[model samples]
Target: MAWTWTLETAAGDVIRRSEDFESRGDAESWIGEAFGDLVTDGVDQARLFEGENEIYGPMSLHADE
Candidate 1:
């Protein structure tokens, strides 16, 4: 199955949505590359929604400024 990444802000705001990939790793790498800066800027909240039932995050990370 393909993996999809959906990123959102702490307040439930959608920031970026990526195309489906063959692997979850690919999807995550895309998320990191696209939003790593925002994440490092102390925007520590995000969610990875995979499907209707498989939302994978609210992960808080320290993103460098």
Candidate 2:
């Protein structure tokens, strides 16, 4: 199954979806590295998916205050 992520705001509005990944691990790693940039772009959360099925998230991009 192809793995991907949906970038979104804190209010749950989607900004965009990421490029397709071959595996879940690769998708997760890419997010870990790119989330800094995403946050700067106004993304407050990310949701992981395997095709149309959500695997996890709405994970926060902000550092806990």
Among the numbered candidates, top TM-score falls to 2
Candidate 1 Cα misplacement greater than 4 A, ranges = 37-44, 61-65
Tens-digit lDDT string for candidate 2 (1-65): 89999999999999999999999999999998998899889999999999999999889989892
What is the overall TM-score of model 1 with all chains considered together?
Answer: 0.57
TM-score of 2: 0.95
Tens-place lDDT per residue, model 1, 1-65, is 66765556677666765577777678778767766666765355566655544567766544441
Estimate the overall C-alpha local distance difference test score of candidate 2: 0.94
Q: Candidate 1: lDDT over CA atoms?
A: 0.63
Stretches of model 2 off by over 4 angstroms after superposition:
none
Q: Work out how many backbone clashes candidate 1 has.
A: 3
